[model samples]
Target: MGALETMMPPPKRARLNGVEIGYYEAGPREGVPIVLSHGFPELAFSWRHQIKALGDAGRWVIAPDQRGYGLSGKPGKVPDYDIDHLTGDMAALLDHLGVEKAVFCGHDWGGLVVWQMPLIHPGRVAGVIGLNTPFMPRGPSDPIAGMRARFGPDMYIVWFQNPDEPEAVLGADTTWTMDFFMRKPAAAPADPPPSASGSTFAFRDLLKMWDPSSDARERLLSPDELAVFADAFRDGGFFGPVSWYRNFTRNWERSATLPGRIDGIPCLMITAELDAVLPPSAAEHMPAFIGDLETKLVKGSGHWTQQEKPDEVNRLMLDWLDRRFPK
Candidate 1:
């Protein structure tokens, strides 16, 4: 077993909302618990490093695989993966664990979900931490139209709205899929990443767009660690995770009624200096909506900030956590 497998807490399961949630819990039952939500193509295993550190500091840490990933249940319908169900899963997890509220920290798509907990279920959130993803208030129009206009139809998010194709591309070659995603960017990309560099690469079109061996990006996981994802995904398949993108329109329609601004809660925004998809600038306007917000930048880091710079992310989290809520 790798350090990750050895250090990771034993897995636990609970029937939450409409699915069985696979989670890992540590530290004491007391204190305001911290729930970790992971992003696309990742599992609670992504938070393995933070889990032990935060738990050892006497903070209750809960990391769930979320629906459709890892040991968690994957419902058949695409609508089942909507924002309401995604956020509802965590709220249900809290009830299962017998906790009232928790400091929800999420990264990637998970970041998007944690940002909503306070709005959808206002009473169940103690604090909010958005890693790489910033708090995005609803735009005047449906985000899908904008995303399609901005990123083009072939863009991963927009393309995912189509059934079978996206997941088919991913599930066809599981090994290459994991390797394509779980890597540290080269100081700069050998080619641009759909940035304003006058170049466009549709990440969803992985088969033709980017090749695994063509670049020098570093591996974020060991062979053993990589297998954990490869094997689980081999069994779990990619539909559940990819279906999350399919809910863009439904999520928008439902969220139209939730409170737009977040106030009266401690929120932290951690930005990655090199995360082009969600750069520091994306979070600049966050203060306009979040009454009490603190921002930190992880230097020379990419999208996988927590795993890429675990020590720095942990320090920033612990320092702010200690000051805001005592254990």
Candidate 2:
């Protein structure tokens, strides 16, 4: 339990854009506005700790479930789930709140959204913060291509983009998939079994073995915490969330035309050291994409930094926001 754990409180829900976007708001309504965006397979409740901390600090905090996940609007069309729609949903959410410009922060896929928001609607962003994901200068290369170039044959993104396969595999057993993704890594087997290559295991199985120790698993999440995620995914389904993976090329093509670099918008990037999905390598050369950038590494944490290490995450966020948009 880090500093954020003690300061956080539960969030409230809202109905926006023809869908119920669960969100939590704190701080003074008249204070500076900070909008927090959630990543795939995550709800606005993910930022529960930060909302209370930031709000108590006298800064207005807004955390939304985003359009496709949780109670937010989930459209049927694949094309409808494009980056334009995703970013547009954020803009509409801001408009709904009558906010002119807000400090934007996000993690994982949410980080991608915050990074692009400043580009798509530069006028509406006061500053930006990205967790896990990094700023890659847009070019002819797509996200899949970048993943392939970086991870080689065993690329998760490439596997995820395979249309219905992932949805079928993960959707069929949501709990199994959740357990797999949330689990920590394990130690190597003492005696390598015959005909047992680590590569032979399914991604889900391998992820389950990530933290073989029951103690680590217990510390990863409580039954109640796991239930929170399970309920959301069970209701939201995997199709809409997986659709985000299918939009790699679409996001790249759209981002290619924007200016090569961001100017004047202060930025902060917090990388989780133990996040299996998003390793430190992912953030390489991020400073090349933003004018003013600050980077921090949270040791002994996984992809769910906000949930796993709330206090540290909150402190870093508050420190950065205080510097960029002082009250």
Candidate 3:
């Protein structure tokens, strides 16, 4: 029906990690396997461009709708969405596909999963590549506590810990929510630093604080492309998606035993130059945590780096793969 629909198509379901995962697969069955993971409020559909590019270039690409998005199974409890369970979904997907190990690429929340997978399940990961989000090591405190101390109660992530409230607010108008988040952020407002006020600005107020006129939603997606996300969110609702944030503390506690550093894995971190939520500066401390990390800055791109600059992201991924996991 649309270019994305034609290129990426619908997903086939696979039972992995005790949940039914909706995934799209392409390329030769024997080709080098690569798993592409999408971020919050996103589906495998977000990876349409990379799926086609990698598939055509002779890769067995598998893009799953993760645990609680798209056509996948939606677990009820917030604890179910913790990092261990999230990484298990990917590990189980490989087992279901008869793959011992595969190159894993993730964006946003997906990036968080890939970064932790190498630390938790080393043997199952061949390499890790992150888009926008970087590998952040856990500090002495629980992540949610740290976030609360840094961003206060109104922060989108902090607000999400309440569960039902956020789900209701976000699901009330899925279309607007989708359009609002998918749009480019407005200029960085002059705000108090985290240390200055004991809490940085609240991103939960983005929809209300930023000017609607500045949003690039109309330019980024056609009604058809937007519908793909809006429709799925409408059906699945935001409960499962928001549940991901609710597990910040659980993930931190579970990962306490993991070594403070992630080594032995070839890692790539791509920074979206204009991404307000996770800017290029976020990766400054990455080298300390990731031993073999390689970094790239996607010029003129925002949070949706792969979707906004598909060719550049794809070329960078392909070249990195050729060098690290060569044929």
Candidate 4:
């Protein structure tokens, strides 16, 4: 057994949505399963802690290194990573798991996909738990256009739109890219005001210009854990992952016909106190849109809320499952 699978279910793969999806799953198959989706530049390994904990609690849980990530197959084109394809991948995975609906729990970009599950494939989603990412209505303009106007082109999301640029930067040194991102926030992380470009995230105006050893930093992953991510990215490169961002405009354009608000379904929004990009304030209006909603804040955690504070995140998630979708 590899170091990554020491506690969680064994890694498995499936062909779904015309792409290869690598996943890990465990626990009873009797109830509505919990499907965990990962975010940008991440693998299913990111949920190493939650999968074991949640599975042990008697809930069927599946975590996938979604398309263009980890062991998953990467389609070459950009539009292939659109919101429909993302949500569809999960729905198809549910079909493979022989279940109809799942309580979707996602962190970072995974959260965005889970939030869209209700809109794109409403029948497949039993519930939602957003770790850091929030459920917001489709904006009046194309999201990429809004980001460009508000944060200029340097903003990471906007920066991702350019073909080959992000891929090159991130692929330059896979280990360094993973190392740069997988860090615990500085002891005294300053919630700096947004830059002149109007971007809310100043702490993470990263990639193009980052100091690997500037601050006395602590890594979120142990050397073995870090190897799992670095090695995967080293092979996969960033094209597939970055392509997800390239589809913002495409996703927004297609969302016009979909339901903007999440009604009926139970929801939980867990915000990280130190996550500048997806801060607690970002989730402020979620309750208004989600009629049945609950919220929690992970004190002192940064963007990597689940990995940083596994116990708290697990407690909150398991508690919600017990109340909202118990066995």
Candidate 5:
């Protein structure tokens, strides 16, 4: 733990756009609004440290659990979870807060949402900040086609987009899935590799490979921290979060309607160096889509940069926000 961790207060929930979005807010109510969006398989608690740090800087920060994760309203229908619904839910949250425009920040899938927000509702965004994920320009063909071309047969996207299969594969073992996503990297392989693409292991087994030493494991997340995540997932299940991957084609079709360049919006992108899923290479051509962009690479971090390195993440975000909206 660090200074940022000590200052974090528990989160509160609110009913926004028919969904009870679990959110954490800090600083004065009348301060400049900064909306923080969480990624898949995560909650607004992911921004716990950020909420405290940025709030102390005299900025109003609101981190929402979005529609489908945590205590938020998790609708049953697949169509209800589309990109339009996701982005619209966010816009409605802003409306509920009586905010005309706010600094929008996102991570992972949330990054994808914020990237499209300026294009979809240019009027609602004052500035943009993306963590881990980046913008990829869509061409004449489908977006997944390019990803498939790059990653080949074993790609997670292919499995995730299958609709029926992932709900079973992922949902069957929610604990393992959560551990696989949160586990840190390892120095060596513990056992011989499995033959098949889907040969599975227990979540704890996979985590052990990351670091055999119990002390190292303890440092990453205490039992209490792990319990916090487990309780949320155990209660919510994995269907809603996994459904995010199933929306790729829908997003592409909707995004196809937007123009090539979106001007006048200030953008900031922070790349996680160790992010295996959305590598830094994906961001190579981002400038082609965004008009004014500022990018940074957060070294020694992975997909969960905000949780992994809160201080560095907060410093970059606060500096960028201050520069965009000076005192």
Candidate 6:
């Protein structure tokens, strides 16, 4: 087992905005603070490799469980997971830590939160970096409405709107869900039957096709590394994590005015060449929305860019940090 396999420390808790947040801290006491946030079905352990690298490089790093996952307080209401509340959690964390502002890095849904942070709590972020997900400007309509109209109700995000059904379906077997969701694109086969020509496809339905018997962690992570995630889900259940999806439209409505507006915040977006969920193409228009943006594509990786290709992700992030926020 590699060092990262055991890198995650026991979570330390801090009550922020009436919700208790669980987070792991590392690196030098006086180093620049960087808050790393994890996405759906992920905990701070998702940043284990990056934490080790950055900590070794003398940067202070904190990876949180966010609002609803891990040891953090899970506010059962879907409305509580909106972007403003999500971004507020980060700002509050900095306050709790006595940090004026910190570099923020996030993956997957966490990436979405970081992008919104600069807009929602601009003063609390020194810089922002995204993994796998990119900045998508708010459109003429609520994203959920457009997604439902285009892709229909079976779409993952749309399907997540109902609340209970998905929670039961995904939570029925947490271990299976974790193993299934963590499949790296390079290792897993595409859904056998392709989507109808020109019609939108349901991502959740496609996920149903994955072989539950095949544990992706075997190829992607050590048993210990995988356990960290599995244990968290087992304890927290899928409600809080899935609740993130339930707030798509609410988040869009909350951040509508900020999108497409130029922000001087230095941004680094890293895409995984093999990520189907947040494909590299999604970033094509980012330059128009972000004035200071740098993009990197990690070949041979999937949605779990930081975990699947840690070394590459860390190198790209640290290099960007040194250049953007030099010590």
Candidate No. with top TM-score: 1
Count residue pairs with overlapping backbones in model 3.
Answer: 0
Clashing residue pairs, backbone N/CA/C < 3 A, model 4: none
Q: What count of clashes does model 4 give? A: 0
**TM-score, per-candidate, Cα-based:** 0.95, 0.84, 0.92, 0.94, 0.85, 0.91
- State, as a TM-score between 0 and 1, how close model 2 is to the true structure: 0.84
Model 4: per-residue lDDT, tens digit, 1-327?
556767557779999989889899888777888899888778888888888898788878889989999888989999899998999999999888788888999888999999999999998888999999999788999888887877666677887888897788788887888888898887645544455566544323555456776745678888788888888988988899989988888988999999979997899999999886688889998877898999999998998988899999999999999998767
Q: Which scores higher on TM-score, 3 or 6?
A: 3
Q: 152-249 in candidate 3: lDDT tens per residue?
A: 87777888888488888777777777787775444442342343234555545554454557554435666787888888999998888889888888
Backbone clash pairs in model 2 (N, Cα, C under 3 Å; residues 3+ apart or in different chains), count: 9
Judged by whole-model lDDT over C-alpha atoms, candidate 2 comes out at: 0.73
- What CA RMSD would candidate 4 show? 2.3
Better of 4 and 5 by TM-score: 4
Query: Mind giving the per-residue lDDT tens digits that candidate 5 earns over 40-74?
Result: 77877778789889888988888887787887888
Lowest lDDT 10-residue stretch of candidate 4: 200-209
List where candidate 6 sits over 4 angstroms from the true fold: 1-5, 187-209, 212-218
Ranking by lDDT: 1, 4, 3, 6, 5, 2
Q: Give the RMSD in angstroms, all C-alphas superposed, for model 1.
A: 2.2
Q: Comparing 5 and 6 by lDDT, which wins?
A: 6
Could you tell me how far off, in angstroms, the CA of residue 84 lies in candidate 6 after the best superposition? 1.1
lDDT for each of the candidates?
A: 0.88, 0.73, 0.83, 0.85, 0.74, 0.80
Which residue pairs does candidate 6 place in steric collision?
A: none
Better of 1 and 6 by TM-score: 1
Superposition error at 134 for model 3 (Å): 0.8
